[model samples]
Target chain A: MTEKAESPAARTSFFYLAIILVTLILSVIALSLGVTALQGGDASAGSYALVGFIGLALSAYMLLQTQRRPSRVTFEMPQVITTILCQKCGFKNIRDFQRGDYVFKEAEPCPKCNEKMMIASIYREVKEKEKERLS
Target chain B: MMLFVAFIFYGQRIQMYIMIREVESRLARLKFIRDEGRKMAISTIKEIGKPQEDPTERVDRFLEYIAIAPESMDPAGVVWKLEHVLDVRDIRFKDEVRLMAPEADEAQLNNLENTLEAALALNIIYKVIRHFYLLGKKTLSLYIIMQLQMVLPLIMREAEAFASALKAFATGQPIGDGAGALVAAKLMHGHEKRRIAQDIVVATVPLEGRTAHVLKSEGPGGNVGKPGDGIRRIIEETEGKIAAIVMVDAALKLEGEKPGDVAEGVGVAIGGPGIDQFKIEESVLKYKIPVNAVIVKEDIGDAVSPMRKEIFDAADTVIQRIKRLILERTKAGDSVIIAGIGNTIGIGQ
Candidate 1:
């Protein structure tokens, strides 16, 4: 929970390994096709070779990317907010949470009616992931 | 052909190696954050406690404090022993905090205790992961490594939850776990309270023309007082004349369930060492009293984090449910108990 600013995707290593394995499997399939085509004296040998080389090249690129330096993990602290409500005027306001703040504590007078407000609640807002809605 | 042969012969080994590397990286992060949590705790103690002697060594020892498991093979009356062990453990922890932070007030000491407890949880999490990682590596056991890796995400998540709780505890902020206590506080806001049990306070608030004995932990600091003992004592004192028991607490929401949703049901609504639950159940069964529950749903992570806005608003909903349950379950002028079972941090009654 420090204020560090850099973090890679949490599953980066496993993801890279999966990608490498998949690319390797694809390269082998492509190479096997090229080998079979050439041994059969087929006319499609050149095309198979081209596809095989492309697959091999892509695999190398992915492996090189994974071998590069990993990103540092970072922690982002959540911001807590305090909610105040005025009983007389029903005036409600929210502000950044401060030390010594607590629930049910008396706070500044309301601007609307000069009535005192109470710290009704103090909490951090949880940002819910947006859902895809059907029209 | 060579690639195929290699895959056929050593595919699982390669996968195991990759998995180990992944676990290793996460374990490193876990260690770093564990150490960071410790540093925060020590620095906070130093700033607030201002002890003449450095508390680092003492804090480390505190982290090592372990709860002894009571023998349960003889299941009869084991709950009593478990409760006693928990009581002793709780007292020792508080004593430790007091010794290290002699300058801190009661409130500060409670917060310090909470901070240290969270740090201790993080410490234990780190040690477990490290132990398993080293064992897996030393023995070259794929199954052990696989099991550890499988549970690593869950372990890391719990560790992060505890880590986040440190700030809330240190700052005396109400966390999501306090949703029930908030309801109790709101209900008993203008009433006077008397200590009914260890750190528990009960306020007699008139609800719908009946005296509602609303109870919760003494607050403005982090404490989930012994509500079970309070309820049991009240039941005994009233000679089983109580109408009903309406309890409120935060329950863990299932996946995809909205946080702050309120649910009403029957039975005791407390969670923890089961000491409180057992007492309440026994007292209720003996008295033949109907027990009802109103719970605010929250995820396990949210329960430890600072009170979420949704959960904060849900407190009002829980109160509403309690009021409705009382009116429907009890006749006019019949007294009842509304037990708010949860940590009463940053809330007062």
Candidate 2:
């Protein structure tokens, strides 16, 4: 199966970088060409300066647009409740706990056939602790 | 940010669904095997009754009728079925010697062997009976006993052998068959009143198709980043992921609390990287997938004495506690990731 991929961060970065590179290349070419034209008495020296100026303006616009968009976005993690369900009879049994707490406790048996239901782990978040510092 | 959060949530749910399916499949397979074993056990027994004649002769004949190599049974299912049978009261690796070859008389040795074997058979029967009441599980073995209410001597014989072995070992002499018989007889005398199956579960996790590094580092607390991120990376790298692991190395009681002793609610977590907790918790918070941990509690030293009922009872209590934990946290359709974290040398690493 083909998965559709879209990276806003990458796309935005790409556009911003392209504008800067184009401006830099244009400015260099304009300066060299202007100098050569002045020395050779070419009449297009004024147009070269204008082209360089426009390039500089475009570069500034790209930088401003990039800054306007937030560099990073924060997402609130979802609150999940881990509940137990019997695979044999599909009996639903909910647990109000995180992962490790169930290592040494007895859950109620499957109400249907009264089979010993092997607890598939409860993958619910209790509460979030602040992110850890590497140091 | 919303899209990113959605991606994480979606990934986590899919993973949880897959995990839940795996556990359900395993449980189903084991249950079927257990049912088959129960049938086999019943078929092997010619008749269930109390013998008044040469008890030894009857016991031997009975064992010959029911004795099937442990290997013949379902490999995975047998352990859970016979878990309560060969109760390893206390296994002392130090100064422990096996029976290499003894120069005892053939009749005496055979008698001793028969006695121990009888005891073992009794243990299986007793366990099968008690398991029903304790776990409320209905197997053919339990149903047979409940309908007839017959007391079998095989269980007593087994306990007597262990007791005799303990006495002989105390005097620092080679264990004789007569001493073994005495132990079996003594073990048979006790009317055990309480049950301990309430707390333990035979928990299994799949680590197949995952990278060695990710699998190796897949412990409770070693991940450096937020546990969610660490696990995500590990799972992504090792596509064949089933559970997130958290390991705890605590000093356990081989022989646990007194039979009626209520547990003092103790601390669950101690020193560790805390990464396993963080990532799993975050993932749960993000997507609602549950992570389960498998804990094995063993005694520190000879602190667990076979002679002491309290110590022996503690092992049962710990086992029960682990089972309870698993049951309480699991659901039918829910996927749970369990990490059996410990140095599994005795049980196999």
Candidate 3:
């Protein structure tokens, strides 16, 4: 089986994480700047503190959203559909095949013909084209 | 600084909202597909109950079934399996027809079988699609949803191809995939048609100084008859006289590869669960016969859905390649088996 490609969610999450980290780093820089300005008795120290606080809050919210988001999803092989056709009346019915159904095996009775519907054919649905288009 | 921070946060929130909306829309699409699948299934059951419906109605119902079917069922497998059941049914039907009208000829018997098989193949194709489509909906997992989204188009294409193939069979028209057989027919004059296996036919085409045993899954209808069995039988009957085996098939091209591109390789190029490929490999190895593969590249969409103009055009290229390989690889008077490997849905020899 082909490996599942990385999901868009995963790629976007990486970018989100990078933004969060950058914001956190900026907050740390602002915190030091505020501390130094306050020691120097600068009035802008309060503004620096406010900027740092807002940066912290923004990063925290981004982090929370990232944690709450769903990760990339994967899947196993698809299922097969089998059809049983009533030879007597030519009536046909289909369903997800069970473990026991085989080609030519006698299956449930035809609702119309009253004769047993033989497992006329079993086929796997082709889904490759849609996937190709998606990729 | 405060205003800048507020602006950035506002932008982030809007971006997040848009992303969520996209995901929600995707989920909604999945739900829609699932519902469609269920409706198709219901429709199929209804169609089956009415066996006296016209061919166009039957075809429409079958297409509906395929549109909603899940992606797991192999279309080729369904057609191949139906060929078996239809073979038995065809025999019985033929017997009945002959008994009723002793004037029924071989051509009439064949026509009857072809019609039945085509109808069955179309029906099976739709059911298979509905099965997968509904299954995907039921799962409701993002992974499965994405997978279904990808495969649904392919299933639709295959359905269309089968529909066309079925139409041709009903009307007695030649289909496009029979290119390999066409090549064989051109090369070999006075070739006799014989069923090597159920729905698989072979003819002896004499090449320039060599005999080419050409085989294809019987068609002008939907059928990918068991070529593995046919090849095996030819190998056994020839008693090791076969010098080389050439398998020609329509292979799925990777993204960026040109459709109808011709390529050569060694080993069995047959696709699927590898059952047939394994059988061919075993026979070739046991007989010590060299195996050569010639493939006409096509996208997954083109390979199964229908024979596109480009794919049909590739046939001439493939034929030239096969002839060249036969001349270069084997000597005159050496018996070679050339098998056209693919669903012979529409093409006929």
Best candidate, DockQ: 1
Candidate 1 chain B, run of 10 with poorest lDDT:
B1-10
Overall local distance difference test of candidate 1: 0.86
Interface DockQ of each model: 0.37, 0.01, 0.02
Candidate 1 residues lying further than 4 Å off, grouped into runs, are A1-59, A108-116, A132-135
> How close is every model to the real structure, measured as TM-score?
0.89, 0.19, 0.49
**Model 1: how far is A47 from its true place, Å?**
10
- Per-residue lDDT tens digits for candidate 3, residues A25-64, read 9998898999999999999999889889988999998888
Residue lDDT tens for model 1, A80-123: 99889998989999898876678888899999999999988898
Per-residue lDDT of candidate 3, residues B256-279 (tens digit):
776667899998877754657867
CA deviation > 4 Å runs, candidate 3: A1-135, B1-50, B53-190
lDDT of candidate 3 at residue B173, scale 0 to 100: 33
What is the TM-score (0 to 1) of candidate 1? Answer: 0.89
Q: State the weakest 10-residue window (summed lDDT) of model 1 chain A.
A: A3-12
Q: If you assessed candidate 3 against the hidden native complex, which CAPRI class would it receive? A: incorrect
In terms of docking quality, model 2 is incorrect
